[model samples]
Target: MSRFRRTWLQHSLRAALALGATFSLGLGNAQAASTTKILVGFPAGGGSDAIARILAERMQIELGSNVVVDNKPGAGGQIAAQALKAAAPDGQTLFLSHDHSITILPMVTRNPGYDSAKDFVPVAGIATFVNAFAVSGGTTAKTFQAYVAQVKQQGGGKGVVGIPAPGSVPQFLVQVIARKNGLDLVAVPYRGSAPMMSDMLGNQIPAGVASIPDFIENHKAGKVRVVAVMGTQRQASMPEVPTLAELGLSGFEEVPFYGVFAPAGTPKATLDKLALAIQKTIAQPDVRDKLTTMGLSVGFMSSDELAARERSYAKVWAKIIQESGYQPN
Candidate 1:
């Protein structure tokens, strides 16, 4: 090749490489596309997985990048939390979890494999949600009161209640309920909501306490009846259902939160950028409607706000878990 032509070709290649590098670093408008992954610590089709998928779709429109969800379901999200800790904090990986993995796990687990305080930083707080006490199809009881009465009359005040996972918030709620109602209720823990839900549908388990989303569809289909929700107020999607507080049960008035977190030391600019994308996604009417339908009180909280909220929730559960006399396994 001629010298001039070779020189021009070399310069062109250099410029293209520079542009690609900048874009790959998530810099500059009109940049090349990149992939961001949202990790869930549960199986697909679960509440957190569903929320991550929904937000990821809308977030792609806002951020103009490919977004995906990766599930690492095990040990009540321990595997996924450990994965997040080992990931590079380049803003490409995020963990979507509720207060269980971030708040309850650390308290109830001897070592959950990740340190939320040091290994992860809050990206965004999506919404607050409630746990529901639901009855299987084989049961005749409708209201929470009726369920308790039936258990007492038929089962000698001894009953079995299912929870999605052990050491979870739902289990603690069960303990509280058993004590309050004077029922000797034993909480049977499961690996995930899906199996626990299956038991509820098939009448293998008479009752369960899980996130409202876990049982909403089944409830709507008349497979299970959500007798009571845990929170200060009733869920808008199920206004007919009463809150535990309304049922004269106290200490469970506060709800749990859903949040996104990135590995520690991620750049502030990147965190802000992702947070804005999430905020925009959450602000979409369709997004809000979908999440609300699934029993989430859709709301947005900033990074700092999420940090404070998590701290406060930790304190909240700390008192509850301590009162329950739970020992980490």
Candidate 2:
């Protein structure tokens, strides 16, 4: 070969190698940017936090990227929702919350930090969880009817029930149940389920209302007795427990659900990818079992379906809140 041609060939090869190296580095950086952060509004050890951590672990495998849970427990999940609202719409940050922060909070409170419709987009629905009306093992009531009777016997000012938080679903449901039954049961709000459950175990309060997951373990250990669940149907894990509707509570047939949401303006592709990863993660047998054991049903909804459900739930809860005359603090 000629000397000029040989020199030109070597130069071309070196330039090609350098371009390839740069392209590889760009891809590496892009992949690194894919790390996901799941933000939980409640403190650790609560139902929402438990689900978030489980989903995060499984999502790491499904998404093929690092996933972490960031707990921002305050203001009944308002802080976490606000953080998510201000986050970059890059799909790396997600909020895992139930209806309290999404459907109910905005309706009851004047300013909940972030508007669900305007500031966020639904990614996927994780599962539905039932709230339970339970009493400590020390209580004499063995059934819902018996419990109501006992509360009635105690009379107006004496009956008190603990709730996970003020302005939460459990709190509102307590009011509805009390009014319907014509019993005067006052609600005592605690910071979260953990503390409420703590008080209940000590019998500081005779009864409490909280997500089934919050009470299931203790109930199984005979520390508490879940007399009834607030949902349309019975939970598979605790088939013996009756739904509130079965006991003539009509409007509460629907249970609260948990879902994932990202800040508005996240790319469609990113949203879809995250939704798919969530679906896959929830479908895994181990993940399904873990969530179920925690009193969550393994129901998954796609992004569009989740958005529709959220809209419908907000409307229904808005009417209920208005009727209840709950003023936001």
Candidate 3:
């Protein structure tokens, strides 16, 4: 009674197991084909976009999904931030942005169209970068002090400077420097750093304020010279350059950050998973070196730590903006 029945039962069980494995394989492939997009607030050739692409390439492999970068450039990244707010809480869409969009935009704009606190949650912190003040090739000034002197000598201590965008932190920095120096300096805003760089290269603008990454390549190319930087200490990429504090311009020790964010209401588990993948990618030697070479201080911060750092950064900028008496746009 037993031999025939036992043999038949074993064969049936093996066939069922094989079918289940085949089904699971097909499901995994389908999931892998689903695309995950990282939204960048700046144009493609900018620092934020570069970082996003690098991280997306690595994250695609780590997350075992299709990861891609989507640029939404305008209004100092207001457009991209608004897109993130409108996105669903699913893990598929994320915003890869720096402090200007996440921390400072709200403070400067009356209505930036998106609220960081209410509409987004920090996923991870990628790196921190510092702002720089640079002059064009046509300018005779070799140093920021000399530039100011030239402005005083040639233009009655009045000059026009380029900024990455309106309501940007660099714009405020221009005011801070002008106020401290007792000169009339006005910041002319552009759409992004790339365009600002273009004007500087063509000598259409005498000087501009932007991130170190934005100007470092040109600084090396000799088209522009980074005369001063905003940080407590000098950068490794440009050790010869002077810090704002060294130039007797203090109180700007706060460094700007680049991080990833998911729309609010996204599950904590999903956020945590993405954060871990980012931490893994940043930990890679090649990724770290690439970002470091771009004048960034590459480091990973936890989601909660990033959120806290963002708030602290906002507070610092808030005071500076208020003291400058700059009206919100």
Candidate 4:
């Protein structure tokens, strides 16, 4: 070939490579710009998992990016919490967890390995709801009042009430109910609701406490009965079930809440974007209706409001922990 023709071919090759490089760089930037993930501190079928999935699906549409729900369950949410802080502070990764792992776990553990105040920034609250204490299908206690009387008769020896974990709201509720009624109810601890529900189904433990919604369908199907609802008022989903107060137990209110958080130092703009996405996803009428059907009310709060609520709840839980005589393990 002629030298001039060969030179022209080489120039053409160089131009093509330059264009490819530019396209590759642009694609990289676009991928980095578009992808976001929400991490849940529990396995699938758990409340956080459900919330993460719902938010991920909706937020993906709202934010125009692929939103993924990653479950990193272990150490009672410490694993996910630590992983969240280690992730890039670019709003690409978020943590969706409930009150126990975020507030209760740290307060009860000597070194939980993550500081909520320093390592994370609140993005938005997802939902808040109560737990219902119920007995297995085969249990003889049919009513909350009857359950109380049965516990009194057994003097807390005849039955064991299972709780997800120590220092959790459900655990405290168990302690409070047992103590207030002068019943010697023993708490059987489980890793989480999934296993606890399994035990209840198997009748390994006759009575158990779980997220209100987790047991709602079962209650509706007549597979189990709620003996007590742990809040001041009857839950909107289960109006027939009475609160602890109405059952003649005063001041037995325990409400569990969940929220979203990003790693600390994440830009306010990024967090705001995420918050807007969350609000948008949660504000839909269908979303609210579905969550309510699941026995969870729509609970969305601003960053500041969520932070303040966390602080106040921490103090209250800390006091309860001290009163319950719980020490870090």
Q: Give each model's clash number.
A: 0, 0, 0, 1
lDDT of 2 by residue, 103-148 (tens): 8778777888889999999999989888999998889999989889
Residue 203, candidate 3: C-alpha displacement in angstroms: 1.1
- Compose the digit string of candidate 4's lDDT tens values, residues 48-132: 6776787888899999988998888777678899999899999999999878778888888888888889999999987888888
Report the error of model 1 at residue 15, Å.
Answer: 19
Name the lDDT of candidate 1. 0.91
Superposed model 2: Cα runs more than 4 Å off: 1-34, 155-157
Best by lDDT: 3
Ranking of models by lDDT? 3, 1, 2, 4
Q: In candidate 4, how many clashes are counted?
A: 1
Residue range 1-329, candidate 1, lDDT tens digits: 99999999999999999998987676644243378889999888778888999999999899888899999998888889999999999998899999898988999988788789999999999999999999999999988999999999999999999998889999999989999999999999988788788888889999999999888989999999999998888889989999898888898877899999999999999999999999999999999999999999989999999999999889988999998889888
Candidate 3 residue-wise lDDT, 100-170, digit = tens: 99988998889899889999999999899999999999999999899989999999989999999888889
lDDT of 3 at 79: 95
lDDT of model 1 at position 21: 93
lDDT of each: 0.91, 0.88, 0.92, 0.82
What TM-score does each of the candidates earn? 0.90, 0.87, 0.90, 0.89
Q: On TM-score, who's better, 3 or 4?
A: 3
